[model samples]
Target chain A: MTGYLVRRTGQMVLTLFLIITFTFFLVQAQPGDYASFYVLNPDLPPEVKDQIRAAFGLDKPAWQQYLIHLKNTFTGNLGVSFGNFPRPVLDVLVERVPRTLVLFLTATAVSFYIGFFLGKAMAWRRGGLFEYATTISGALLFTAFTPAFGLMMIWAFAFKLGWFPVGKFLDPLVWRGADVSANYVFGNMLLSAAAFIAFALLVMLCLKRFGRRVPSVAAFPIVLGGALIIVAAWALSGIGGLALDIVKHMVLPVATLTLISFAGTMLLTRNSMLETIREDYVMAARAKGLPDKLVRDRHAARNAMLPIVTSLVYSLIFAIDGSVIIESVFSWPGTGLTLLQAVRSEDLPLVMGAMLFIGMLSLLAHVIVDVLYVYLDPRIRYQ
Target chain B: MTDRHDPLLKVDGLSLSYQTRLGEVQAVRNVSFELARGSALGLVGESGCGKTSIANCLMRLLPDNARLSAGRVLLDGQDILPLAEEDMRLLRWRRISMVFQAAMNVLDPVYRVGRQIIEAIETHGVESTDTAARERVARLFRMVGLDPQLMERYPHEFSGGMRQRAVIAMALSCDPDLMIADEPITALDVIVQDRILRELKAIQQQLDMSIIYISHDIAVVAEVTDVVGVMYAGRLVEMGDTSDVFRAPAHPYTAALMSSFPSVSGERRPLTGLPGEPPNLSDLPQGCPFHPRCAYATDVCRTQYPPQARYGSHWAVCWHPLDATMAVQS
Candidate 1:
C-alpha cells in the first residue's frame, strides 16, 4: 500500500507539472497581453509604454518567460496579478480561495449526504411514491440550466418572498454591531476538542495494554467536554447576532448549489443502487434471512458505492470549479471570482496561477479518490 | 415410516404468479410436497419449470411483482404464509435457509467470505458477538472442506468450486432445520459438482437436517436425494423415491427426461429430444401443459387437465399414467 501511494504521488506530481505548463501556454496564447492596456492609453508616451512593457517582462521570449514562471511556481512564487496591479498573485488567491472552499464544501457535503441516503432509500423500495417523486424531481433539477436555476431561486425566495438576502456572503448592516471574535474562540475550542480526543485515545490504549476491554463509551467524556467548549465559545463570542446575518446571506447561493448538484448525486446513486440490488449476492443476502434494510444497506449499498465514490471525488472538483459561475452570479468574492476578473482583464499571470491551483486541487482529489477506490473495491489491485 | 402429521416442511397447494406488464404469469401452480426430517428431496426440472420458484416461495423471497396467490408453507406444522414480515424473517435462516443458484456469484464480491457468512449468523441474532460469529464462520468453512485461513479472501480470489463451497457453508451457518438448495451446482463443472454433492450429502447426514435440493440433472438428484419430484411446465408431473422414479417413470415427461440421458446397462438406443418448448405461463394450452410435447398425448390429453393418479405410494399427473405392467408389456 505504501509503495502504491508513493508511485501514485509521483505520477500526480508529474501530471500536475504537465498541466501547469500546458495551461500557461494556452492562457498566454490568447489575443492580447496585460500590458496592452497601457499601449491603448492616449496619455502614454512611446518610452513610457516600452518601460511598462519591460516592467511586466513582456519583452522577453515566450519560452524564457514560461521557464521563469515554472521556476517561480516551483519556488512558491505565483508572480504579480496584472489585473489587480502590483498585488502578488498568491496574496489575491489567499484572500479569495478560502471563501469559495467554505461555500462549496458545505454545499457539496450537504448534497452528497442527503442525495446518497435519499437515493438508497428510494431504490430500496423502488416504484413507490417516494421513488417516483424524488426521481422525477431529481431529473428535472439535474437537467435544468444551473445559472437559470440560481436566477429563478433568487427571484422566488429573495425577491418575491423576501426571506433571504439577494446575494453576498455577509450582511454589512448586521456586521456593524455584531462581535467578530467568534471565529477566534471557535478555533481555540476546536483545538481543545482535538486535545481531549487525543487524551481519550491514550486512555483507551492504556486500558487495552492492561488487558481490559475498553468500554464502548470511553470517549463519551471527551465528546461531552468538546460540546461544552463549543457552547462556551458560542456564548462568549456573542455570535448569535452574527450567525443569523451569515445564514441569511448564505441561503440563496448555498441553496442554488445544493439543488443543482444533489440531483446528479441522487441520480448516480439511484442508478447504481438499482443495478446492485438485483445482483445475485443481494438475493443471497435476502435468502439468508437478513432484514430488508440490512440486505439493502450491507449487501446492496456497499457494493453499489463504487460508482458513487468515483462520482463523489469528481463532484468535489466540479463543486469547486462551479464556483466560477456561481460566484459571478451571486457577486461573491472567491478564487473563481478572482479568476473571472483576471480573464476579463487578460491578466495572464493571475489566470495561470488560478488554473494551476485548480489543476493541483483536481490532481489531489483524483489521487485521494484512487486510493479510496482501491480500498473500497477489492477487485482493484494496486498495480 | 414417513408420517403426514409430523413433516418438517409441508408445502400444500402452493401457487405463485407474477403480475407482468403483459398479464399474470402462473409461475407455480398448486405445487404440493412434504419433506420429512433428516431426509433430502430433489425437485428436478428444465429451466423455468417453476423449480427455482418453489425454492424462492419456500424462502418467501419472491420478486416485487410475484405474489404467493394461494399456498400454505408450514414449517414444523406452523403455517408461515400468515406470519408477519418480521416473524417470517426470524423463521428465515434460523428455521429455514436457502442456498441460491449460481453459487459462483452468490457471495458478495466486495466482502470477505467469512464476513458474508457471519452476516447470516449475526443477522439472525445468533452469536451476536463479532468474535463468536467469526469463529462460527471459520468452523463452517472447515465443515465445508475449505481452509479456515482462506476465509478472509474475497470471492474473486477463490476458485469457482471453492466459492460454491463457501455459499454452502453460509447456508449451513445457522443450523436451520431445512436447507433449500436451488440449482447450487449448475454453474460448476462435473468434477466440482460431484465434490460439492458428496460434501453436501456428508454434511446433511452429519447435521441431520432436511433438504429440498432443486436441480435439472437427474444423475445429480439421484446421487444425493432420497425422494425426487419431477417438475414440468410449472407443475410436479411425478414424484416418488429416486430409484423408483428413475427405474420406472410414471409420467410421460419424466420418461422423456430419463431417456434423454444414456444408460450404461441398456443397449445404445436412439437419443430422442423432447420436442417443442415449455408452454408460456401467460397463454398456456387449455388442457395438459405437456400434451403438445408428449408422444402418447391423445384427444383426451389435449382437451382435459390430468388429475393425480395414485399407484400405491407413487403418483403422477396423467390420464394414461405408465405403470410396471405396461413397462413389462413394452
Candidate 2:
C-alpha cells in the first residue's frame, strides 16, 4: 500500500506540473492583450495605463510575464480578474467551487446509480420487451442531438407544464439568514451531523439484519425504503432546499447524459457477462451445485466487472467535458458554464483555472481507478 | 460387490445432431451405454468421434443449435431429456456432476479459492456458517491432498496440477453419485496424468460413486475403467469388460487402436495407423460411417451398416469379424 501510494503521489505531482505548465502556455497564447481593456478607457491617462501594465508586469516580454504569473500563482494569488472585479481570481473561484461541486456531484451520483442498476436490469432480462424498449429509447435519447433533447425536455416539463421552477439558483433567504458565512458553516455542520447519524443507523440496521432470511419479494422494497429515509435525512438542513432544487434542475441533464453513457456501458457489460457465462469456471460452478445467482455474482460478475470498471473510470473525464454543453443548455452555474463564459470572453486566468481543475479531477479519478483495478483483479497484483 | 442393483445412469439410443449452415451433422449416432453404481465406464474415441458431444448430451449442456434427435437419458430410472431446467439444475452437482478437461481455467481468478468453493457449498445449502464452511473446505482440501492454507490464494497462484485437483475437489463437494470426467487428464503431463488417474481411482473407491471417464487414449482407459467402449464415426463400434475386449478384440477398429499405441509389455511390431480420417458427420457415407476407413471392407460392408453382434458378454459392430485366418491375412 505504501509503495502504491508513493507511486501515485509521484504521478500526481507530475500531473500537476504538466497541467500548470500547459495552462501557462495556453493562457499566454490568447490574442487580446491584457492591458487593451484599460487602453480602451478614454478617461485613463497614458501614464496610468502604462503604470497598470507595469504593476502586473505585463509590460515585460511574454516569457517574463509568464514567470511573474507563475510566481504569483504559487504565492496564493491568481493575479486579478479582467472583468474589473476587485477580488483576486482564486478567491472568486473558491466562492463558486462549492456550488459547482453540489451540482456536479449530485448529477454524477444520481445518474451513475440509475444508469448502473438500469443497465444491470436490461442485461439480466436481455431479450424481453422492457429490454428492447430501453435499448431503443436509450439510443434515440442519446443521439447526436442530445442538447436539442435537453431543450425539448425544458420546453415540455419546465416551460409548458411548469412542473419545476425553471432555470435559476434558489433564494438563499429561504434556507438561511443574511450572514452568508455563518449560515453556510452552521448549515453544513447540521447537515453533516444528520448525515452521520443517518449513516450510523443504516449501518447498524444492516449489521443487525445481515444474516436474516428475508423473503426475496420484500427485499427490494425494504432496501429502497431505507435509501429514501437516508436521502431525506441528509437533505433536511439548510442548503438542502438548494440541493433539492439543484437535483430537480439536474434531472433532465442527468437523464440526458445517462442516456448517452448507458448505451456503451450496457452493451459492454452484457457482452462481457455473456462471454463470462461460457467460461469453464462457470461450468465448474454449476458442477459444484451452486445456485445460478451465486455463480453469476461471485464467479462471473466479479471477474467480468474488471473491463467495465476501467471503462467507467476512464469515461469520467469525457463525462466532465460533456457536462460543459449540458450546463450551457440547462443554464446551470457550474465550472463548465464558467469555463464556457471564460472562453467566450478570453478570460485566460479563469479558463486556465477551470482547465487545471478539470485536469486534476481526471488525474484523481484515474488514480482511484488504478488502485481499484488491483483490488478487483488479483492477477495484476501478484504479476 | 456384485449385488443386483439398477445402473445409476442408462443412456438409451442417444443420438445428437447439430443444424449447421451446411447441413445437419449427426454428431452422436445411436450411442447406448449403462454405468452401474460404484463402477467406472470409459468412452474411448479419437477426436471428432462424438465423445464430447455425448458428454454434453448427458449433462444437457448442448448449445442452441445442437438437438437431441433421439434419446432417453435415464438417471436412476428418471428420464432427464424432458426435465425442466430448474429440476435439472437440482440434479446437477448434487446427483450428477462433470469434471471438464481444462480444469485449471475453470476457476474464477478474481475470488479466493476457498470463497469460490464456499460459494458452491452454500449455493447447494451444504453449509451456512463461515467457520463451518471453512471446516468443510479444509476437509475437502485434505481429501484432495492440498493444504487448506492455500485456500486464500487465487487460481493463478496455483500450479496446473493443483488447479485440476481443486476442480476435482469442487466436483466432489456435493458428493454426487455419478461423476462424468470428460478427458480430465488429457491436458496434463504424463506423470501428472498418472497421479490424477490414481487419485481418481482412490476417490471412486472411497465414495463408491459411478464414473463415466471419457478419453482418447486406449491404454489410459484400460488402466482406469472396468468397461471400455470404443467409438468410431459417432457410433459405439465395440464395448465389453476391459479384459474380455482387450484379450480377444472382436472389432477391427479396436484392433487398429491397440496396434497404433506402443505397448509397454508386447512384441515390437511396425506401428500401424488408421487408414483414413474420421468422416465428416454432415456428409457421412450411406452404408457405414467407418467403411471408408476400414481396410477389411467388403461389398456387403459398403452397402449395409452392421448391427451390434454379441459374443459372450462383449459386443462388436462389424460386417466381418477378424477370425484366425483373417488376422493372418491382415
Candidate 3:
C-alpha cells in the first residue's frame, strides 16, 4: 500500500509537470502578452512601451521566458499579477481560493449528504413514489443549465423571496471600518471546517481503537460537540457579523450549486445503490440474521459508497472548472472569477498562476481518491 | 420406515414464485420434505429445478419480487412461515443459518473474514463479549480447516476453497440447529470440493446438527448426504435414504440422474443423457414435469401429474415407477 502511494505520488508529480508545461505554452501562444496593449498604444512613446514590455518580462523571447518561468515556478515564484498590479499572484490567489473553497466545499458536502441519504432510501424502497420523484428531480437537476438554474435560484430565493443577498460576496456596510478583511474571515472559515473534519476523524479513530457499541453512538455527541465549538468560536469572534454577511451573500450561490450538482451525486449513488442491493453479500448478510437496516446500510450501502467517494473528490476538483461559471453567475469574487477576468485582460502571470493552481488541485485530488480507494476498498490495496 | 429419526425441519406444501417481465414464475411448487435432526439431506436436481428457491424459502431470504404464495416451514414444531420479520430475523443464523454458493462471493469484500463471522455471532448475541466471539470464530476456523490468523484478511485475499471454508465457518458461527448450504462447492476445484464435503459431513456429525445441501451433482451429494431428494421442474420427484434412491430410483428423472453418473457397484451402462431440456417454469408440462423427458412416459403421464408411488422405502412421483427388481444390480 505504501509502495502504491509512493508510485501514485510520483505519477501525480509527473502529471502536474506535463499539465504546467502544456498550459504555460498554450496561454503564452495566445496572440499577445499582458503588455501587448501598451506596446500597441500610439499615445505612449516607443521607449515607454519597451519599458512596459520589459517590466512584465515580455520583452524576452518565448524560449528565454519559458526557462525563467520554469525556474520561477520550481522555486514557487508565481510572480506579480499585472491585472491586480503591485500584488503578487500567490497573495491574490490566497485571498480568493478559500472563498471558492468555502462556497464549493459547503455545496459539495451539503449535496453529498442529501444525495447519499436520498439515494440509499430510494434504492431501498424502490418502485415507489418517493423513488420516482427523487430520481426524476435528481436527473433534472443534474441536466439543468448551470447559469439559468443559478439565475432561477437567484430569482426565486433572492430576488422574489428576499431571503438572501442578490449578488456579490459580502455587504459593504458590514465591512466598513471593520478591523479584518473578508479574506481573513474566509480563510478562517476554511480552517475551521478543516479543523472540524480533523477533529471528527480523530474521534472516529479513537472510537475504532476502543471498539464497539459506543463508537457509532458516541461519534454523534463528539461531532455535535466539535460543531458546537466551531459555532461558538465564530460567534465570539470580532468578525462574526462580517462572516454572517458573507454567509447571507453565500446562500443563493451555495444553494444554486448544491441544487444543480446534487443530482450527479444522487444519480450515481442511486445506480451504485441499485447494483449493490442485488449483490450476494446482501443476501448473505440477511441470512446471517442482520436486521433490515444493518443489511441495507452496512453491507449494501457501504459497498455502494466506494464509487461515490471517488466521484465526489474528482467532481469537487472538477467543479473548480465549473465554478468559474458559478462564481460569475452570482458575482462571487472567488479565484474562478479572478481566473476568468485575468484571461480576458491577458494578465499572463495571474492566468498562468490560477491555471497551475487549478491543475495541481485536480491532480492532488485524483491521488487522494486513489489513495482513499485503497482504504475504502481492500481489493485495491493489493494493486 | 426404518427407525425414523425426529424431524428438525418440516416444509409442507411450500410454493414460491417470482414476478418477472415474462409474468410470474412458479419457482418452487408444492415442495414438501422432512429433514431429520443430526442428518445431512441433499436435494439434487438440474440447475433451474427450484433447489435454491427451496433453500431461500427455508431461510426466508427471498428477493422482493418473489412471493411465497403458500407454505409452512416448521422448525422444531414452530411454524416459522408466519413469524414476524423481527422474529424470523431472531431465528435466522441463530436457529437456522444458510451458506450460499461459493461462486457467489457472499463474503463482503470490505470486511475481514473473521469480522464478518464475528458480525453474525454478534448479531445473534451468541457470545457475551467480543473476545469470546473471536474465540468462537477461531474455533470455527479450525473446524473448517482454516488458520485462525487468516480471519483478519479480507474476502478477496482468500482462495475460492478458503473462501468457501470461511463461509462454512460463518454458517457455523452461531451453532444453529439447521444449516442450508445451497450449491456450496459448485465453484470449487475437484480436490477442494472433496475436502469441503468431508469437512462438512464431519462438522454435521460433530455438532449433531442438521445440514441441507442443494446440488446438481449426484456424486457430490452422495458423498456428504445421508438422505437424498431428486427434484424435477420445481418439484421433488423422488426422495429417500441416499443409498435407496441411488439404487432403486423409481422416478424416471431419478433413473436418468443415476444412470448418468459413474457407478462402481452397478453393471456399467453407457452414459445416456436425459433427452430434452427441463420445461420452462412459467408454462410447465400438463402432467408430470419430467414426462416429456421420461423414456417410460405413457399417455397417463402426459395427461395428469403422477401420484406418489413406493419402491420399498424410497418414494417417487411417477405413473410407471421402476420395479425394485430393476434396481441397479440389486
Give the alpha carbon lDDT tens digit for every residue of B59-116 in model 3.
Answer: 8887889999888988878899889999999999999988887544799999998999
What fnat does each of the candidate structures reach?
0.87, 0.83, 0.85
Each candidate: what lDDT? Answer: 0.83, 0.76, 0.86
User: Arrange candidates by DockQ, highest first: which order?
Assistant: 3, 1, 2
| Ten-residue region with minimum lDDT total, candidate 1 chain B | B321-330
lDDT of 3 by residue, A1-383 (tens): 57776887788778878877888788887887787777667898988878888888888998898889888988999999998899999999988888887888889989999999888888888897898898898889888999999988889988899889889988888788998877788778777879999999999998887877554878989899989988888999867788788889988888888888888888888899999988899889889989899999898999999989988987798788887999999999988999999988888888888888888888877767777888889888544
TM-score of each: 0.90, 0.89, 0.95
Better lDDT candidate (1, 2): 1
| DockQ for every prediction shown | 0.71, 0.67, 0.75
Worst 10 residues of 3 chain A by lDDT: A209-218
Misplaced by over 4 Å in model 2 are A72-84, A98-135, A171-243, B1-4, B323-330
Top candidate (DockQ): 3
> How well does candidate 2 match the true structure in TM-score terms?
0.89
User: Candidate 1: misplaced stretches above 4 Å?
Assistant: A1-7, A40-44, A159-163, A173-231, A238-248, B1-5, B263-270, B324-330
> Using lDDT as the measure, which candidate wins?
3
Report how large a share of the reference interface contacts model 1 reproduces. 0.87
